[model samples]
Target: MQEYADPVIDWLDGGRGYFAKKLYRESCALQPNGSYTKDLSLVEEDLSRVCFMDNSPVSYNWNKANALPIEGWTSDPNDEALLDALPILDSLRFTSDVRKVLGIRGF
Candidate 1:
């Protein structure tokens, strides 16, 4: 938790978590009767503003991989406890998916 403080500090001090308020404004501008041109411009403006202030640019590379060995392990799961927890984790995932399908509010 101590490691998480700097970003929190940066956020509260003159940062664009402040400008996230503009997301609502920009969203409103996209309404049917709003200026279509200005709406689009505000959308892009908010997006760039967010990316700039947050330093998370639009581009990213994603990847997937198969197996990886742990420091002193021979195979996946590594121990009995991880193997035991797998089914519980899978059940929680299924429950989450079911909640999503049912339009559960706080998911």
Candidate 2:
């Protein structure tokens, strides 16, 4: 998963390192017993400060209030999903708790 995500993340940000952390199936988010279920609390102690984006709802099962669900990216030239989300992402950075905005927006 890390190998697959690295290129996609690079392409999205042009290797500028926009993402502070990258967690995958093999990351600390995984259960200590080696289960696949993710509990993001392991990766970030403060759920209020995190906004996890995933195409799969199951991925954010443990933290639905803090999720920012996005459609899976295809190579669609007309795709503007990310573009549409920029304003929210940008504004949330200035807020005290991201979950407050996410919840209010019904994300």
Candidate 3:
């Protein structure tokens, strides 16, 4: 994690772990067409078991079926996007194939 993520993290319980290494990847599709996305393949994790959440839908361009959309955070005290996503994520924990679930949800 970078210095930008430090302050907010210090407020949550065990927040540092949430920002642990391998939690994210760099942009792989930065082009004139404006698809600034991250390729999940770079993470080397099993796609079947992986579900990605991002505020920007384009980040899911490469593997959209596995995408989980969340609202962008702006340090708003009233933000509840993460809370809204918890149930879906909780169900994902027991999924054998994340794509199937996300696909059914129309992601």
Clashes of each: 0, 0, 0
Once fitted onto the true fold, the runs of candidate 3 whose alpha carbons sit more than 4 angstroms away are 1-27
Q: Ranking under lDDT, best-scoring first?
A: 2, 3, 1
Q: Score candidate 1 by TM-score against the native.
A: 0.18
Write candidate 3's Cα lDDT for 1-107 as tens digits. 23433454454325545422243334366758866777787664678877777777877788898899877788799998877877887787688988887888777
Q: Candidate 3: how many backbone clashes?
A: 0
Per-residue error for 1 in candidate 3, Å, reads: 9.0
Clashing pairs in 2: none
Local accuracy of candidate 1 as per-residue lDDT tens digits, 56-103: 111110100111111222334445543443353344335423223223
- The numbered model that scores best in lDDT is 2
Instruction: Quantify how close model 2 is to the true structure by its C-alpha RMSD in Å.
Output: 3.6
Q: Which has the greatest TM-score?
A: 2
**lDDT of model 1, residue 25:** 26
Give the alpha-carbon lDDT of every model: 0.28, 0.75, 0.69
Off by over 4 Å in 2: 1-4, 7-18, 28-36
Worst 10 residues of 2 by lDDT: 28-37
Report clash pairs, candidate 3. none
